[model samples]
Target: MRHTDDKELIRLLRLSDYAAFEELHHRYWLKLHKLAYRKIGDRQDTYDLVQELFIEIWEKRGTLNFGEELPGWLQKRLWFKLSGFFRKRGFNGKHQENFRQYLENQGFDKCFDPAELREVNACYEDLLAAINKTIEEMPNRMREVFILHRRQQHTVDEISDKLNLSPKTVRNQLDRAIARLRRSTEAYDATALEILFIVWLIF
Candidate 1:
């Protein structure tokens, strides 16, 4: 598809046209997957993230700001998604005063600089690796419950039915999974919190 076709496709997308969604997905899937891969370094995660990104864009098309370049706009949204992933993973704050002071020292224009971007990516990669490692080491039952609830997007009720466990048991398993993750990454909490703060500053 030509660059000009993006606008027409987006227009159609706003009207919930299936063809438009399919064409846009065809046009950008590879690039979006590559973008997600560069940050995540996991093939499955990259594919899932990209798919989620497109689903979100398609769902919100009526209110989307396509801007001049669709890819540019998409990248910004992907960054936000990545940031949210970290935030949800329990990056504990390092004293409110320290966080505020750190934010005060940073400026907006540098968010896009090569060095700053590298630092941001490094922080993100580190946190992601740590989280994945922790999850990998989870107890079998907890891991299964965590994966079903978080990665597979299954509801607790659904997981309980699938696993033949009580709903409270499923919820308890998920809570334990999160607690274990937080404990596993406590050493990096300060750095991850600072990194997440920078992300909030940027977008």
Candidate 2:
């Protein structure tokens, strides 16, 4: 099983082969953990995120589909996990500064001079302002629901009960609110759009 190819391991996984699953876990655990740690900057959170990724993989193994590259697929799933983690925490000034430091530590200074870094930070702030403005422009009820769910860290069920709405309605409001914010990004240029994507990931 240790020498089995990814495709073969995946095949065995779908059939509920424990050895193959263990082998796959052993193969990627360190690499995934390192990636998660770099992005999250917390040992415990990184461990939890990577563990959750593998658990999800196993739970959905029966429906799993890998294209040409299994590693890429796993990494993509991890990226989504990271995005969700940041979203649940609610991005604020501290996280923005941490991300900037992360970039600098990754040698972004070699790619972007001090002036360019300042410009990127400015664009990032501007995009955030635009998103907040869009959120504020949402319908009254929608804005309330979004604030409760996102800013106040309330779950859909909690928001529904507080607002006297169905959970489905709360979810719909959130979906529409997110869609409106996405549309607002279209007005930005490429650089701003790139910053918007990063904001989306952490927001």
Candidate 3:
């Protein structure tokens, strides 16, 4: 009767209730679409990924735990699928090259085993979510500086010119943004912390 309860839906799902699956799909599909679109930046790919995600969810429904963290689990699964896409394309050269170099510069040189890589990639997804949360919590000027530097990939001088602020002010704002993010994520485990550091290094 509790159709909106994820635990109830998951219970029905495990029992092969198509309607329950449909309800879950209806609830989450748009949010998943936006998430996939933001990550892949390709409309066709986002649609394909969303389709694949739900199909897999249905096929594997019996195995699901139906925990409170199902949404986070879904996000981690999507990141894994996104990594597979990157692997198939051999990382598209320049983007992967820059990412790898950025990590190396942050003192991460050892090759990650498949399991390690998957874990790190999942942490990357978590860090992205954390960054978004931190940005939303930041003061307006600090948020502007953070988004310009992180999302738009602007240089300090570039952001200063665009925002009509002195370069020192821009740098200080950026530093404050980083400090805020660091404080927010301080509770993460050591390995996830390293992944977050790599993300900051790259941006």
* TM-score on alpha carbons, each prediction: 0.45, 0.53, 0.49
Q: Residue by residue across 35-74, what tens digits does model 1's lDDT show?
A: 5554455687668878888888878888988888887677
Worst 10 residues of 1 by lDDT: 112-121
Off by over 4 Å in 2: 92-97, 102-203
The Cα RMSD of model 2 versus the native structure comes to: 16.7
RMSD of each: 14.9, 16.7, 8.3
Off by over 4 Å in 3: 1-3, 92-203
lDDT of 2 at 128: 54
Deviation of model 2 at 201, angstroms:
6.9
Pairs in clash, predicted candidate 2? none
Per-residue lDDT tens digits for candidate 2, residues 1-203, read 87899989998999999888899899999998987775566788889989999998889889977656888777656766765676565444444565556445433534543233222333444455576568759999999997786546588899989999999999999889878877786676535334434543333
The per-prediction tally of clashing pairs is: 0, 0, 0
Pairwise TM-score winner, candidates 1 and 2:
2
Candidate 1: misplaced stretches above 4 Å?
1-4, 90-203
Q: Report lDDT (CA) for all predictions.
A: 0.64, 0.69, 0.66
Q: lDDT at 180 for candidate 3?
A: 82
lDDT of 3: 0.66
